[model samples]
Target: MGQDAIAPPNGITHIVWDWNGTLLDDNHANLAALNQVCAEFGRAPVELEYWRAVFRRPLLACYEELFGRPLADEEWARLNQTYDRHYSSLLPSCRLADGALQVLTSWTGRGRTQSLLSMAAHRHLEPLITERGLTRHFTRVDGRRHDGAHDSKAEHLVQHLEAQGISPSTVALIGDIDDDARAAREAGAHAVLVATGLMSRARLEATGHPVADSAAEAVAMLGD
Candidate 1:
């Protein structure tokens, strides 16, 4: 579907938003962190286009792909730690995506129930949302807990909807990665991939979901 065609024939009432690349314009911070990790591992820094092309969920897979080999348990842990440190240091300089606030405010005015569903740790996610002054826009905000190895958002989406007493059929997920689409599909909800975030438009289109060029356009797709 085209960017303008996100509205499903069946109506939509709730929205599940991705954090890092969807509403927040933090792809630069993500790439910078990854590049720092690469440098520490003696690998070349990757270009933005390449990062967008190869980014994936179960993030370890993406790191392994870039590193050209599987990571040992401790190595993976170290890499994760390093990336987190770098990203945290860089996050203060990152800003929300263009039109993010406007779209969020508009949706709130329309009484659309929205929630943030991210793989980022809850400790980190909650503070960032508050720091960005976006906490009021969402009915609920969730992030990965510290208890286990959180990888995919699919199962989390199921729990999120269940907790909200919302049927999957009434929700649409907007994100910047293929994993987001996969999660939405697994949960039986519609998915809208935004191109101006983590992934390239070509890569997002390959997921066979409607792609929006901006947050405003993505919001526009859910017409009145």
Candidate 2:
């Protein structure tokens, strides 16, 4: 007789979501914005697949990779300024990913709690979430304070849980990148990644976390 394959650890009482490519679906806008920035620097435009494959944090490294050289502090700042301006102008046309709203609503309806955590600047992030009328769904919404723009999510995730009086062990973090899994584990929570971000499924799977194709699928893996 053979035993069953073990199911992944997804049992949790709370869900924490990542913004940007996960829920916001701003991949097109982000690519176009970066391409425009590259144009100013006399670099060729990059295809989405190439961009996705190379994208990772500390945003500075991703910028350097796209430009094919090291960026001085001033050059990096200028590039980021241009990218942010174009991105903001294009953002009104973007929308959330498929099943993003349904998953958030479904999780809430089940009487469990959820919140949002993003590396976006807080001033910008708050208004955007408010404009979408999504504020009611989250127990708390956190975005970076701008002073730590290039840092990872682990530190912020720690603060988010502590502020909510939620224990990390009872949490499940859903995000679209490998960093999300690393950050979640570093902060002592379960991680489930969706392949909806810049990273491919194979790449996300390499993080050794359960991977899903969409937000609804990710939440479902966490079970009842």
Task: Give the whole-model CA lDDT for all candidates, comma-separated.
Answer: 0.85, 0.86
Candidate 2 regions off by >4 Å?
1-7
Q: Tens digit of lDDT per residue, candidate 1, span 1-224?
A: 32333334247788899988888898889989989999999899989989888888778888888899999999999998999999999998888899899989988888778999998998999998998789999989999864334587888889889989999998989998888988998999998889977778987887778888887887777766
Q: TM-scores of the models, in the given order?
A: 0.93, 0.93
| Candidate 1 lDDT (Cα, 0 to 1) | 0.85
Q: Model 2, residue 118: what's the lDDT?
A: 91
In candidate 1, clashing pairs total 0
Clashing pairs in 2: none
TM-score for candidate 1: 0.93
- Residue 63, candidate 1: Cα error in Å is 1.2
